[model samples]
Target chain A: MNLRRKKLWMTVTLAVLAAAVILIPAPALAANPIERFVMVEASQYAFTPATLHANPGDTVTIELHSADVAHGIYVEGYGVSAEAQPGQPVAFTFVVTESGVFRLRCSITCGALHPFMLGRLTVGPNWTLARAAALAGLAVLAAPLAVRRETA
Target chain B: MNRVSLLQIPWLKAALKNRWPQFTISALLMAGFVFAIVAGLVGTPVGSRNFGIIAVWIAWWAILILAVVPVTGRGWCSVCPIPMAGDFLQRRSLLGPNGGRTRGLNLRLPKLFRNIWWQNAAFALMAIFSAAILTNPRVTALALIIMLVAAIGMSAVFERRSFCKSVCPVGGFIGLYSQVAPLELRVADAAACASCASKACYNGSEAGYGCPWGTFPAGLTRNPACGLCLECLRSCPNDNIVLNLRPFAADLEKPAARLDEAFKAFLMLGAALVYAAVFLGPWGNLKVAALAAGTWPWLGYAAAFLLICLALLPGLFWVAVRLAKRMAPAKPHTARRHDFAQAAAALVPLGLAFWAAFSLSFVFANGSYLLNVLSDPLGWGWDLFGTAGAVWSPLYGSWTVAVQVGVLALGAFGAARVAQRAGARGGLHPLPVSGYSLALTVVMMGLLL
Candidate 1:
């Protein structure tokens, strides 16, 4: 094929591939409801079992235990918080209404790295990450075709 | 391809020529800098509530990376306050040239240490201890004071702005990425500059001080060395100096020729990766080690940080360059060292993007602290703005991840274009370099998302 025709074909193919990636259907929801109980230990600047997973619409009961100082666990997207003192465990229950990754941060000042003390709550599959990965791959593939070759 | 001279605008030209406006801005910033030092030393130990930490790290850092560097190209350096005290001590007059009666030894910077190697080392040293300096207000205060004293000391001995040009850590990265900014200060008529005998731009002519950055306008071709101080414009008798708006990344069309600058790209890119993993990732042990500062784990962390920035990343890139050479050798047989430096130009955009993306997450999460700190600057419970009681909250939520992904994608594309241009110069293949950028982007995305 001629150069112009070849370029046109490549552009069209890339567009189709991008659409396929973006339009891919998410996994079907689970038919039965379930309850997940997780115990998270909070220390000076870390949370034990830093990541928690649950299905969308499932009830998640998180019991926070402070191993050292006073600490509070606040979940982003859920907007629920629980405070636990040393030797005392506080629990909060929230329904996972969405299907994305959320950060669980320390609501109370703990130490020097208090702001960065964090954990992840994943509900269902992390499709945002999957889609971002796909888009990034497509971006790398599309880059060379976007610029014309120039002679030195 | 076309350039519009900003000097043609009457009021801007007048404002730039007048030293008062620049001096006033620098003075205000210096006051803020002094206040930050005081706040850090005596204020509340809470880093989130301390003005020293929130204002400088969050507010100023966001503005420098997201707006100033990308839009103005070393514009921050034009009025930077760190060098103001030094300039004052050296010149003995702030308003004008002082009739060329400057003080100090006025010795030239040594030939061996003239390049940005000092800047690279200084920046690495700071990065190794950044977790502590970024978190503890006292450490931040000490770091700021050290920088201030270093600038004054360099100015007391060196001729002009040797600290900013070759020593300042932040200035080093700003200079490297300024190559992508659209704005440039250049001579409108090179012939005018060549014919002029006084050459007031580099030497004081009573109208203004000489180029603080120590660059000659006639030989200027890129944005890395030009601080955009406009001294040349104030001192030019023939009206030859002009600030122009041109295409972005215009300077990267010419490949990098210096090894120090090339290593700067590697260092910055590696820093972004390491910072993301340490600061934004869920690795708690890493954070502890980074903040422990001078302990065994911290020492190990520091060693790994330097090794990654100085050896591992650059080694991998060199291997890529070697692979490219084998895959597509230059017809004219370009030297490997030259090709390595030239190919590093592609990392400038990628590094800038990585920093911007990382800053977005950090800024959005902690930006609200700026309000509280503004009201209670010293955290002594003074509510100047009635925001001292403001609650802490993260802004934009999960949208930050989406925005970070978009920024990284744009950066990858820009880097690919630069790599393609470098490949066209006959030494390197674009694929390996572009692949390197793409892999880093994916890893960064994984970290942020």
Candidate 2:
């Protein structure tokens, strides 16, 4: 094929590949009708289960318990927060309205590494990871062809 | 071409030519350093609440990564406190020239040990122990004290900034990345430098000492080694030194690239990814391994960390480069490895973006402590700033997500452009070289998102 044609073909192929990767349908968020319950134990420097995964529209009722000193949970994006003392559990509920990862951080001054003490709330149908991976593949594949066209 | 020389501004020229501004800044930073060390030793042990940790890791580190390196290349180096004590001791003057006689032995650094290997090693060592260092004020203090003593000792033995040039871990990476910063200090005219007989920039003039970072400004092109001390500006007899505000990543366009620098790039990219996963990711096991000392899991973590940083990432990159070379329009006359090494510069922007994005995640999420710590730096219940009781809250919230994505995209584009330019200069198609950059973007996006 001619150089122009080759470049055209490569671009189209990249676009199609990227589209295919992104459109690889995972199970949709908010498909389930059940409420999710998880117990999160916060301590001086770490959270028990570092990640909590759920789907959009699912009610996630987290029972926050302090392993050591008093600690609080501050869920990002969602304005839900609570404080729990040692031997006392504080519960809070929030519906995952967004389909992305949100940080759940300690609101209290736990200890030395209190700042980094946190967890993740991954509301499902997180297509960003797939899309990013696909784009990367496309970029790698198309880059050489694009450079060739430039040089040509 | 998109640039104006800062020296053209009369006030800027006057300020740069004078020693007072830089001297004052350096002195202040040194004082802060001393305060940090004292506090780390005598005051609060809590890393989040301690002045030493909060000031150094939160405020200073956030600013350094987010602002200083991005806007002004090597600007921090000009006022870094590590070298202040050494410089003062060597010159025997805080703000004036020492009559061309330094108090130190003034010995030349050994030729065999030159280059950034020492810095790479030092940085690697630090990265291995960063978990411990970041969480403990005492450990942070010890590290600072060690660096200070080492800088002083090196100054006493070797001539002019041997420690910063060839030893400092932070300086090494900062120097490497500073190539992408718009600000640069270069001689105005090469002809003037060549024709002049005095060579005052290298050997001290009455106004200033010799280039402290052991570089002759006449031949300097990259920011990796130049500390931006501005000694050359004061010492230049021919009035050739000019500080230019040029386009970013100007130095990355240099015709030749080095393996050490390429390796540094890989190390940086890998470290940023691993740090993100360990420090920010929802992985408790990883953090445990990273933070736990003298355990099998910790050893495993360290080994994996080093392997990933030093080998796995580079190894993957090498494969990508090899694939690109095979598919390249023009076959390279040089060894494939050499070409791959040179092409590694293409990914520098992406690496920088990774660091920026990581810093964004880290600093924003934890930055609220700065207000509280400022008021209660020692966590001794002393509300010095009256803002000590400020509640912990992450800054910017989801706003950082959008900004990080934009930054990564810009970095990818820059990296691609760099690869194309480098390829054109080397009589090759640049596209193949961009593969690594594109792939790295994916990784960065994954981490950041």
Candidate 3:
């Protein structure tokens, strides 16, 4: 019973640590209190704007549209993810606290070269993190309507 | 299984003994599976890089389930990955009122929520997005850890047999398919059981053990809710309930009636349907949006569920019920319920058939993944065999379609055999309900497989 209780405590501690690791980024990579826009287009497992530049403390929203199949916009260095739709546009938003070059990739299972789907994001000074985030959000909000109008 | 040595078939005797070995292999397998997911996040398996999620799952599950069953009987139930998390909460052994040892302090589930089909539906929901589930390290890690913790906790708190029979999906499959096993535990005498007073099957006394599944040995079939735990083997005084040497695929004399058994059929049917619609269906919209809505998947899934229940299930059931009514015009109405149950039970064979089909697909589809594993044993890349994902590499690739078709036929044969064993007594018009239901399940699986 003591062993089990200990095990349970360990599990809880581990879970908490894991959650912290995921939810809270490093102090250096402090979240941009708010984010702005960063629309990335995905085609044949590659993002259109393969490289992005932004400032720390910015909440960047990424509006993603897939040209071929299902593609996930994943920011590895910052633990960011956005799954893209083939026809419709999908979006994800995250705060950029850490200033560094974050490698992004398509996490969705597209096809042969799905693994090669790559991009880069540089977060540093002169970054209007909140504005970039707002812009990203606005882009996301505007996408569906734009798509609808085009289809209509 | 505790019987005379069979020199004739060494394999069958071994199967009966190892029918269940309290497997911890799955915990290990799950650890590897978890590692794979982490690999996906941090690095990538060059093998699975080009492979579909469905193919990977199919390949792994096929090798595991098929190989495990023939050697271990119903052992997989103990280690099934899907239900391990649910089992902890679903346990019946927790403390409760109106109880000395409460039958179950089990999760007080709703009536509709009781069936295995519900579990199957749950599995379908997971499987549809299993790509993300399998690849995401955080998700996979959480799932594995959850399962490990739940299993250990449930085992510690609950009585033996309570968790496995009721909660796990893999266990559900093991129990359902175990009826096809060659060996079984059965009472030597029904008359002896009626006269005996200290029914060890129920109230297991100090002298003899009781059936943990809450079943009487005399009343038990092969491995219905029985966990193959063998506690009763020690408890019986008369030595009445003996494990018998039966033929291969022997438990066909009766149809099963557990909600667990019923759900597996639904799971198999649902799995086949999901794959077809997702991969081969004419719907272009779902295909296009398959990626975008990964985080929140309920949208597409809700639509799929509606399509299956409101449409496909009804269509199949209607056609089946009609044909059944026609085939067995002479069968009694009481027998019809039994027939319906049996037909539903026949889904076991159909389910197995689909496994074979899926296995065939794995050899073709994910066999590519294996090549990467083979060349890069350490996964260092640069194909040693020079045929990494070389399309024509695997030998089974030659006849995958043919193998699938053959498996479907075998499934039909197996179902007919099961019907006969279930006492269907299929004459020219033995029991139309079973024939039709079995036929429909087979036909649908055949097309889908």
Interface DockQ of each model: 0.64, 0.36, 0.01
Tens digits of per-residue lDDT for model 3, B232-264: 555666766566556545555556544445546
lDDT of 2 by residue, B1-449 (tens): 56688888999899988988888888889898998888899878878888898889888998998899988879999999899878878999887886567888989999955888888888888888888788889988999999999999999999998899888999988988898999999888998998888787888878789889878887987887789999999988888888888878888776346777788888888889889887877666677677776899989988998899889988887776676666667775777667767788887777888889888987887887889778887778999878988877778566797677656666776677777777666544556556567767777777667
Cα lDDT, all candidates: 0.87, 0.81, 0.51
Off by over 4 Å in 1: A12-16, A19-25, A29-32, A149-152
| Superposed Cα deviation of residue B265, candidate 3 (Å) | 1.4
Give me the runs in candidate 2 sitting further than 4 Å from their true place: A1-34, A43-45, A128-152, B426-433
**Which candidate model has the greater lDDT, 1 or 3?**
1
* Sort by TM-score, top down from the best: 1, 2, 3
Better of 2 and 3 by DockQ: 2
TM-score top scorer: 1
User: What C-alpha lDDT, on a 0 to 100 scale, does residue B255 get in candidate 3?
Assistant: 63
Q: What CAPRI class is candidate 1? A: medium
lDDT of 1 by residue, B1-449 (tens): 68999989999999999989988999999999999999999999889889999989999999999999988989999989999989999999877687555789999999976899999999999999999998889999999999999999999999889999999999999999999899999999999999999889988688878888889999999898898888889988898998999877888888667889999998899899999889877779999999998899999999999999899988988998787777775555778888888888989989999999999978887788888999999889899989998977778466677788788887888888888877778567788988888888888887777
TM-score of chain B of 1: 0.98
Rate residue A33 of model 2 by lDDT.
53
Cα displacement (angstroms), candidate 3, residue A111, comes to 5.8
